[model samples]
Target: MGDPHPKIEARAVTRVFGRAARAVHALGPVDLTVAPGEFTCVVGPSGCGKSTLLRIAAGLLRPSSGELRIRTNARRPAAMIFQDYGIHDWKTVLANIRFGLDVQKVPRREADARAAHWLDRMGLTDFAAAYPAALSGGMRQRVAIARALAVEPEILLMDEPFAALDAQLRTILQDELLGLTQTTRTTTLFITHSLEEAIVLGDRVLVMSARPGRVIAERRPPFPRPRTGAVRATPEFAALTSELWELLRGEVGAGAAA
Candidate 1:
């Protein structure tokens, strides 16, 4: 049979900030496709427009050229998690998780049930009434993640959601995320600077050049599916991480100079 249609497709996508001589060419002429149930990660230098590419996919920013297409029948087609933990302080943990459902006008009872389910799954059940200020950075991030997952989005765009956490906590959440996404088979696009993270979490890892970023290399982890943190212990994982770093090392210097 023919290949199934892409869940997310971008063709010659580009983004520019400002205009005239002040124009900052932030991203693309990039082309990429994410198939249904795929987890893709992007790794690049600091100024490489990694986040710009994600924001464009999220429909939060308009690209200067090219096109982005998302094909999914999900009531909420996409949900995004940011590094800063996008949960609202004004909303309690339960309410924060239910926010999207509320916006979609889901029945109040159903929304509450769904939110509560995710709260328990994320280990936030006891903190249902707590505000963002009352939680630690890790817990607040969990609330943000629970809120996104409660909506059951077809596409999950995560921009270094675990980047700020301590190493132990980051691994804990990474393993949790691996299990969740594998079970749901959600199409995910994760952007991170950590090569090990990209390898551990992504089926396919794409490397980008500096500044005006473009895909420089694409590598798929040879590891099997339903992966956990143990995959990082294998020799292949180390080699692949080293390979990606070499591809990115020069770009890092270039981005710094730019």
Candidate 2:
């Protein structure tokens, strides 16, 4: 079911890199809508432009054609969490978490309150004074997530935020993220290479085709929300995985070849 009121709308959005001489078609004139509080994940082959799609939505890149609108009724923009954990090494964990609020000129009292809340939720209260260098990859990503969420944006865009973590920690963060997003009901557009991650975290999972990417399949996991990693063990999860693998595996190989 779609949200009666959508938070993000991408209409016939297309992205191309470079000019005529050396052009690369990145994404589609694909239409996408994110309902407030919905978590939508996209999975595709390597060159399929999953990240490109996110960049356009984040307003980091303008679509080559068509329009991408954020919170149509307001001006609030989306916040993005990157795979590399884009936190400043010179800043303390708390400081990094509060950076967005600071930029927006949020009052110190309220900014501090928001930062502290997210740090605690992200399980980073103990590392508030630590720098990015001192934290594990997983911990660093938590800070990145905390920083993004602290701003309380209507839309969240994530680009493989957990792809660098060890398998065990990735699983842990995936569960934590699932819980956090569901609790907040934040609308999210996440990109991932892992099909399991896509199915586990997304209320809906979108599969994209090769370069010049366009959504080829959309899967709505029938499982109820509040998903923990344990859901990955179910028969339903396996079936979904198998179904998507057929569409994604060749793309994966194709992506690698490219």
Candidate 3:
């Protein structure tokens, strides 16, 4: 069983862009938590501050009101993988993977060893010398994952990291991620628009409303872990997906109507 204490916690967190009359209430009064070693996914209508909440968790953005608590002894605390891959064009695949380890001041030889391990794991060993320009979309995303994992972050935050890939590639990476997270037991918070993806990847799926996003519903799939594409074929999977969509449909429609 995972720790009862929250690895990540938010209390009435909110965000607003600009001031007064022009102020755009982007998120919250949202409250949520992720237990240690848990994989939690968030789904919401477009422009619903899913990314804003993620940014707050990543400490890249501060909430306008309320608080976020991330409990980790590690210096970096978290590693984030973005949809854009976020690797440097100037660095080789190997360098990109080592970048975070280096920042942690992991020794040179240790960093190289750790980077090499992830390169092999991500199947990027062949492209170790190549820059981001040389890799395919899926390959680039793998590199991004490798870089994030190499740091051994206490919490992993992903913002639709596989969303841009084709369906086939997305499934492949999803399984790979499931396997890695299961093995490492890294706490993760993922954001996606796909209810199927959220159901497939998360231990619990959180649904958010349209703009000024607030988590309005949550669902936990009954299927057991080491989950893969095989789970999608089960009736239970379909039922859960339908259930989450029912909760989301109105919010999505409202966002569209707005």
Candidate 4:
């Protein structure tokens, strides 16, 4: 079948919010595509509509104009992992991971088995019976990821999932995520403000302009997976980060000024 098509595609998608007096142009005529088994990261200054773009791709919000398409054989469109680890406080780790499967009417036993498999793989088996409140920030985010993978969707949409963790924990989780992606090969669209993260994790990085965001640059990383601490110190990695910073610094300053 001619190698199939992109797992998700966005064609001139735009999103605007609020009424005339308070109307905000969050995004404008953005075009992007995420291929199967590829990892793409979107980065930009604050309030540049990075999150808005990701939400549109996930079908969580409809674009005000243009088209967002997700092609998948699975009934569930895409699974999202939020920055805040959006797990239910009342639900135990295992239960939270199984929620999507439960909603889709997968057999309870099968769902439990799948949850256990991911929990062990994610190193969260011991915490399965614990509630969200009991887990550390990193552990909670792991649960969020496991929950998304439970649904076995065609794409994973992540919105700064590691931003809230401490620097050390964030780095640790970043490496863990790289390993997870390698094993699962899930098409992913990850959003982040960290240039280091974008360089380290993404196969390609898309840089956006200031508010009313539009793609300003696209960079392909030269490193191979699984990306490690060593890659970050390489000349190629440093050069990519410097280039991305040059593109983003002005937008960041402008956003802050406004």
Candidate 5:
């Protein structure tokens, strides 16, 4: 019964920065959607406005024109996890996770309980008392995820959350993220530069054009859920990745030339 629904919709959304003669068209009128319980990844070269698009969806940045709508059954708004993890270095992991709930005016005891639950779920229970500085990159990211989930938001928007981690750590986090998504069934929109990562995590991959970014193509992986490391080796996976790479290579080259 957990059928996909339109949890987030972006229709003809355009974003421009600066004034008069210096104006920069960061994003074109892009149309996109994130379905309920689906993980959609947006991949493109640098300056493709992937992060800008996500910020707009999270309501951090207003679009110069067009519309972005987030709909969910929950009263809370969507939560965002940034590439830097965005944790308070001075605060304990538990404190950081509880921060959102506190802002929402949830009771202290209730917030602490919810934070504890997610910390345990994300395997951060042992580091509850530790500060961001004391944890490794992966642990910091887990705390970020726990913090976002603590609020019980209907949607999760991630802007290359694993881009800074090492290869090994990134792989581990990818699997962990998938597990979390499966268990909670949260609607997610993830942005990444790694095509392999996009294929691994995304139900649908949206490839964007360079500069004045727009959705160039949308590819749905043929594989089923509960995807594991083995799926990447299959012929179907290879073909899909190759096709995306072919399309992306030209955009990346064009961006470089500009």
Candidate 6:
């Protein structure tokens, strides 16, 4: 039977660290849901538990309280991309692409086919033989992203995946990632500090408060898709981004103070 639950669901999920006197509440009482094939962008100030939320969702860290449910099938589990390019210096671009498929025990030929597909799709065909060190920062991140997508995961969690690159390269990679996600229809939760990045990449942008973070506001961008060029110039886009900034300003200052 088809699953009735959301692709990803979190009910009053919270995370705290340390004892009573030194306790640091890192996240919720947070509630969140990402529908199948939806791309939701999360934004907040530094140290706002945005990355903490992703780690919890990715199953890397257990929540101290609340229920976090991820409905994933055997063939398509969740995958993650961190802010740092998660690639192996020793592995060739093509080998990195094949990493996840190999882990799944996919047949050699089929794994090669799938990895090759992503490498080409990500515009890394020319660099297929190169190691991570031989590639530029943007190229390495693309390899990381391609590897995650190559797994054909039902849900993808990314924590500021493109934050390391220069502005121009970041934009290019953003477009590439957006196009790939559209094609795959993968359910994704993307965490970023850039409001424009969130707006550009998200179907809905969730803004969180400072430490002990929680979603304080959200913007479901009405901008039409293929969200490529020229959309950011529109008044509506500006208005929505501005609203998001206003929501985040105080939180950013608070984060800075503490």
Q: List the residue pairs that clash in candidate 2.
A: none
What is residue 49's positional error in candidate 1, in angstroms?
0.6
lDDT by residue for model 2 (1-258), tens: 755867878899999998997998888978888888899999998878899889888888889999988775435567899999999999999999999999989999999999989988988999999999999899999999999989888788999999999999999999998988988888999999899999999999999888878888899987887767788989999999999999888777876776
Point out where model 4 deviates above 4 Å. Answer: 1-4
| Model 4 clash tally, residue pairs | 0
Q: Output the better candidate (3/4) by TM-score.
A: 3
lDDT of candidate 6 over 1-258, digit per residue (tens): 545678889999999989899999989888999988889999999998999999999888999999888887656589999888888888899999999898899999999999989988888999999989888898889999999999889999999998888999988888888888888889999999999988888999999999989989978988777677466788988998898899999999999998
Please write out the lDDT profile of model 5 over residues 172-236, one tens digit for every residue.
89988888887788889999999999998889999999989999999998878877766778998
Stretches of candidate 1 exceeding 4 Å from the true structure = 1-3
- What are the clashing pairs of model 3? none
Candidate 6: segments with Cα more than 4 A from true spot:
1-4
* Better candidate number, 2 or 4, judged by lDDT: 4
Per model, state how many residue pairs clash: 0, 0, 0, 0, 0, 0
Residue 13 miss distance in model 5 (angstroms) = 0.7
lDDT tens digits by residue: candidate 1, 1-258: 634999999999999999999999999888999999999999999989999999999999998999999998876799999999998899999989999999999899999899989999999999999999999989999999899988889999999999999999998899999999999998999999999999999999999999899999999999999788899899999999889999999999999998
| Full-model lDDT for every candidate | 0.93, 0.89, 0.93, 0.90, 0.91, 0.89
lDDT of 3 by residue, 48-92 (tens): 999999999998999999999999888888999999999999999
User: Which residue window of length 10 is worst by lDDT in model 1?
Assistant: 1-10
RMSD of 1: 1.2
